[model samples]
Each structure stands twice: as structure tokens, then as C-alpha cells.
Target: MTSFPQIDAVYETHLPVRDLDRAVEFYHDTLGLELAYRQEARGMAFFWIGGQQTGMLGLWQAGSAPMRMVLHMAFRLGQEAVLAVPAELKAKGAEPLGFEGEPVREPVVIGWMPALTVYCKDPDGHSIEFLCPLPDAPDPDFGIGPWSRWLQR
Candidate 1:
């Protein structure tokens, strides 16, 4: 077998959007990802995720009559910030979601991964997640549940 370089981390991902400008505003102004570069001729915009060298996210314009798709991507954050996402997103008129994709009052802990996470949707309905791995041991038996419950365990 040919030896390939072991994978490290995801450097970038792209999402199709109905409007590049609106998506750029949501990702830059709302989500606070730093604007990296933009190509107006191609109707594309790129943003630095985490930091300039760590990760990048590309937003591409889906022209008229484009077929729709729902994609998922996550951003890692510190524990405290993950806990605050529900309220912060709500304040910005975005709905925070639990694992089941329903409106949530707080972040949920997916016990198998033991990660605290919350989800929101972009204007194009792509799933966006903010998460932080927990210090606790993995508890696959616990499945997924409220963040508060995880703390009491």
C-alpha cells in the first residue's frame, strides 16, 4: 500500500449560498469570522475560521435556479463561549438548536463525544455548530442530553 501523509485538520470547506453578500454578512458580521478574501468576478468570498492560518471557509454564490442542499460544519470554541451561544444567537435573532434540530434554551452535551455544542442555521439553512470538547470521560451510554445534566454527572 502506498503510504500517504496522515491527515491533520480540516483547512477549509465551502458552502453554496443564494446570495454571496448576505452570506458574507452573516459569517463576517454575525458569526465574526474574519474576512479573508473575496472574488467578485467569481461571486465567491472566503473567511478565516479560527485564525488566518488555521482554517478557512469559502462561500460560493449559487446562481439562479440552483438546486438546494443542506450542509453541516462546526467551529471549535472555548467551553464558556459554547455555553453562551444560545443567548448570543438569540439576541441576534438566530435560533439556537439542540441535537434534534429544535429550538433550544441551552447547549446540549453529546455524551458519546462528551462535547458541549449548540447549532444554528445560516440564511441558506446550512447547519453551523459551535462546540467544545468536555473534560469528562466519554459516556456512550448517556447518548445525548442537556448540558446541565452532564455537569451533575
Candidate 2:
């Protein structure tokens, strides 16, 4: 039998957006992602998730909102960077949201993975997340709650 190929990480993910230019501005300008390339003829734009070669996010011009699907994607960052993302997003006029999609002042911790995370929505309504793994041990009993509550554990 042939050995199974080892899948490392997500190389890329594609998203359909109503407007390519607006999506580019949100990913490249507001979120500060590195624009990898643009194919005007293809009606698409690509951004580097971490760096030039690490991971890629592609945004395709899908015409209308009704035709596009709302999706969610997470960007991994350092502990400090993840903590600061909410404030920076807010300053850019984006709302930092919690698991329930309510505005939150701090990041949240998913007790099972115990990862710190915060969310925001793109102009096209796709949910974008900033996340970091916690150094602490997992506590399933905690369920999911704010970062402060996680710290108290």
C-alpha cells in the first residue's frame, strides 16, 4: 500500500466577495495583510496570511451578496498581538465580536482548546478571527468565556 501523504497546514482558502476592491482594502489595508497578487482578468485578489509563502487567502469577485456565502476564517497571531487586535480593529471602525456576535472589549477563550480568540466581520459579512493558543492547561468545565475569566482559572 502507498503511504498516505502528510498534510501539513492549510495552504490557502478562497472566499467569494461582492466587491474585490473592497475586500482588498479590508484584507490588505484594514487587517494589514500582505497583498500577494491581483488578477484583474480573473476578477480576483490574493493576500498572504502570514508571509509571502506561508499561507494565502483568495478573494473572488462573486457579483452579488445573495450569491456569496458567509464564511469564517482565523488568523493565528502571538499572544500580545491577539490581545491587541480588538482595539486596533475598533479604531479602524470594525466591531470586535464575541462568540455570540456581540461587541466585546476582550478576547474569548474556548475552554476545550483553551485558545484565545476575538472576531470581526468583513465588509462582505464574512467572519474573521484573530487567535492564539493559551499556555495554560485546558479546562473543559469553563466552557467558553472572556479572556479575563480564563486568566482567573
Candidate 3:
């Protein structure tokens, strides 16, 4: 019989925000992620995503109003699932600065990476990406690069 690995901590990350509605708009309406929960007491909101329990995002009503968020975040979307993200963002009034591929809307296929990635800036100026895994691509060294560099792989 085969055994599964013990589960430890799950989820990718939690992003802090000042307004739950704004975050929901950017993540849900703009990015197309489903809004899962909103906690008023905790001052947080969660987006619905798969792969792990609570791998979505968090909205916090702390600090000053939405300043330039220097952090970056990425999410996975399979090949067919990769479509409609940039269009959705543009339709919602967010411009896609650049992407991994061609002129516009051309999904960048990084030979060494496993994602066809498109880049965009959220309302808060934080960078976020929708990545669909390219399982056939050559495995790259994700550990050696800077935090942001990993996204380019």
C-alpha cells in the first residue's frame, strides 16, 4: 500500500488590505476568483481557490489607506483555465502592463517554467499574476532566484 505525505501548513499567502469591498472587487470581480468569506470582527475577507484549504487572500482594515503595496502574488490556472483573466481585468478597467508572451493577450510560455503567465497590477499597485501550470516544460531552479524572479521562470 502507498501512503500519502502528512499535511502541514497549507495555502499560498494572505494579503492585507484596508477595504474588504475593494479587495473583493479586484480579486473576485476583476480577477474572477470567488469570494468565499468575509469576517467583520477579524476585518478580513477570503477568496475561493483550490489546491489547499484557505489558499486564497485576506483583507485587513489596518494601517493607512491603500498605499503602494510593494508585495507580489501569483495564482495557478491550468492551460484552458488561463484564458479570460486578462480580458476580465481589462473589462473591469485594469490595464495589463505586460505579460510573458506576445503583443497583448499572448500567454508567455517560459521554456523553463511550468506556467503560461500574464502580469497585471492591482488597484493598490501590487503585482499579481494568473499562472497555469505547463507540466511539459523543463523543470527550472525555482530556489535560486529572487522572490520576483521565480515568477518569470
Candidate 4:
């Protein structure tokens, strides 16, 4: 039997939105994702995740109900950039939240993943994260900490 081809990284993700315009503003203006293209007739828009020719995120206008299952998506960033995302979001009137939706003052270190991450929500209530691998994280186990405290230690 022939073996299946190896799978690579995710190329794109399709998310349902109630209003294409609003979604576009939130994703492009607020989140800083580049607008790749749009299909107004189909009520759909696409954004370049990291670069113009890199990964893409598609937004389809077809939902009225609130998101039933919370979807989590993370964007990779440098350590300084990850730590700076929360302040930038707040300055743009976006709420930076913790894992449980609590207001966050800093990014949290995910002990298991050994990564620093900060969370927020998009206009459609989808969970968004900015993450970076912790360079000096403990080898065996390092407890999670807020960015402020984590930086001090």
C-alpha cells in the first residue's frame, strides 16, 4: 500500500462573521493583519496572517448566533513583541484577557508549552493569542507568571 503524503502546517482557517465590514476593520485595522482580498458578492474577506504570500485567514459572513465553542488561535511573535501586544490592544480600545477572560496586565507563561502568551478577543468573540517561546524557561518545570513578574525573575 502507498503511504499518505505528510501533512504540513495549517495553511488557512475559515471563521464565520456577522458583518464582513466590521470583521475586516477588527482584523485589519486593529489586529494589523494585511487585507489580502475580498469577495463582496459572497460576503467573504481574506487576510494575510504573517505576510502577503504566507498563511491566510478567511472570514465568511454567515453567522448570527454567538460562537458556541470558543475557538483559540495563536500568532507567533518575538518575546518583546508578545509582551507588548497587550498594551497595544488596550490603546486601540481592545480588551486584553487572561485564559478565563479576566483583564490581564501581562502575558502568562504557559509552563507546559514553555511559551509566553497573551490573550484577547476579536469582534466576533474568537480568542486570539500572541505567543513566543521562552528562551530561559526551566528545563524540567517552570511555573507560569504574569509578564511583569516573569520579566523581573
Candidate 5:
């Protein structure tokens, strides 16, 4: 028998931002994500985005302008939680930076995951998604399964 591999590592995500305090307030208040820790180092502020041990978000505050929108990070909202995402975004005064259909364009009922899914950008233009369980699908797959399966080529 083989032993299942466990991820014994801390996840760190670095995001460049224009304002650290505003970002902190938005992440904590609007998204309901709690702050774990913060650093006032020379040009950055590392914030833990969830509970004390969930993960950390690194904010690089060395620039006057907000970072570009070339890339983004996402989070899973489970099946039931996906349903409330749009309303939550609206309440937060956010407009979708992506399209209005398909994988990242719009929220749709995906046959692959059997859930209602929607993708959007955060205050710093990071892409995030929310998904609700499928109407008749069994179980759930949180991630894309494998890197190769996600490649377009």
C-alpha cells in the first residue's frame, strides 16, 4: 500500500497593490476574510487572508499606481456558497472585469464540475470564482484536477 501525500507547506500569494490599508479593509469587510498578520517592511505588507493558519496574501506597496491586470488568483466558494457570490459582489459595488459567459466570461452551469460557476476580479484586479453544487451531480472536484488537463494546447 502507498501512503497518501500530504501538503506540508504554507501557501503564499504575492499581490501588488496601490494602498495597503484600503486593500486590508476591502478584504476584511467586503469579502469577510479575516486578517491573520501584517508586516510593515520597506515596500510590502504580508497579510494572512483567512484564519490564523489558512494562508497569506503578500501586498507589494512600492508603487503609486495599482498593479496591472495581467494575472489573478482565485478561491473556491463550494456549491452553496457560489449562489450568493454575485449578490455579494453587487453589494460590494464590483463590476465583472471578465466576460459574461463560459469558464471565466460569465457564471454558468458547468457540466464538468456540476456546479454554478462565476469568475470575477477583485479590487486589485485578481480573478476569483464562486461555484454552487450541481443540480444532480455527485460529489465535487475543487480544482482543475491536473495541470495538463487545463492546458489549451
Candidate 6:
């Protein structure tokens, strides 16, 4: 049997956007991602996800048709920062959503992943998640709740 080489982690992801400039504004201005560079002729832009040269996300302009599938992208953040996402997004005129697409009043804990997560949509309707794993999270089981409530338990 042939063994496949071990893969480390995702290096990058490309997303389709209707307008490259708008996508750049949201990612670079609103989401606070650093603008790596842009290719005007190609109608594409790249943003640094974590740090300069650490991770990359490419946004390619999709002329007319909408994205075939709404993509979900999760970013890992410090615990406190993850907890602050809802308010932060709201302050920037964006609505924070839960996994069910409902307004997120507080961070939700996914017991299986044991991570505290908050969701929101980009200008192009792509789902984005900010998450941080809970220290000593309980064994995987279905769990979701407001951060205050989850922490109490």
C-alpha cells in the first residue's frame, strides 16, 4: 500500500467576489486584514490572514454569476478577541450571525470542536467565523450557548 505524504495545514483559500474593490475594502478595512497586493488586470486581490507571509486569501472577481457555493471560512483568534467579535462587527456596521443565521447575542460554544465561535457574512454573503478553543473544554457533545452562560456551566 502506498502512503500519502503528511499534510500540515491550509496555506491559502481563494474566494470569488463580484467586485474586487468592494471585497478588498471589507477584508482590508472592515476585517482588518492587511492588503497584500492586487492584480488589477486580473481583477483579483490578496489579503494577509494572520500575519505578513503567514497565510493568504485570494479574492477573484466573478464577472456576473454569484458564487456557486457559499463558503465558510474560520479564523483562529485569541480567546478574548473571539469573544469580542459580535460587538466589534456591529460597531463596523456588520451583523454578527450564529450558525443558524440568527443574530448572535453572544459567542457560541461548539462542544464537538470545543471552540468558542462567532459568525458573520462578508459583503458577498460568504460566511466567516472567528473562533478560539476553550481550555479544558468538556468531552465533545452538542453544546451551544451565550458566552456568559456557557462559561458559568
Best candidate according to lDDT: 1
* lDDT of candidate model 6 versus the reference: 0.84
Steric clash pairs (candidate 3): 17-60, 77-131, 77-132, 114-134
Tens digit of per-residue lDDT, candidate 3, span 26-117: 88877767777888787887776772365767666556654545567777776665556667666788765445322344445444665566
Clashing pairs in 4: none
lDDT of 2 by residue, 1-153 (tens): 999999977889989998899889999878998888999999999888878668999999987844657999988899999899889999998999998898999999999888999999999999998989888888899998999988877
Model 6: per-residue Cα lDDT at residue 52 = 65
Candidate 3 wrongly placed segments (more than 4 Å): 1-12, 51-54, 65-69, 99-103, 139-153
Error of 4 at 30 (Å): 0.4
- State the C-alpha lDDT per candidate: 0.92, 0.90, 0.63, 0.82, 0.57, 0.84
Off by over 4 Å in 4: 1-8, 66-69, 138-143
Model 2 lDDT, full chain set: 0.90
**Residue 25 in model 1: shift from native, Å?**
1.0
Over 93-119, each residue of candidate 6 has an lDDT whose tens digit, in order, gives 889988788898788888766888899
Model 1 per-residue lDDT tens digits across residues 19-111: 899899999878888999999999999999878879999999986565678899999999999999999999888899999899999899999
TM-score of every candidate: 0.94, 0.93, 0.67, 0.86, 0.62, 0.90
Residue pairs clashing in model 5 are: 79-132, 79-133, 99-105, 101-105, 101-106, 114-134
How do all the candidates rank in terms of lDDT, highest first?
Answer: 1, 2, 6, 4, 3, 5
Worst ten in a row by lDDT for model 5: 144-153
Backbone clash total for model 1 is 0
lDDT value for candidate 5? Answer: 0.57
Write down the lDDT that model 4 would get. Answer: 0.82
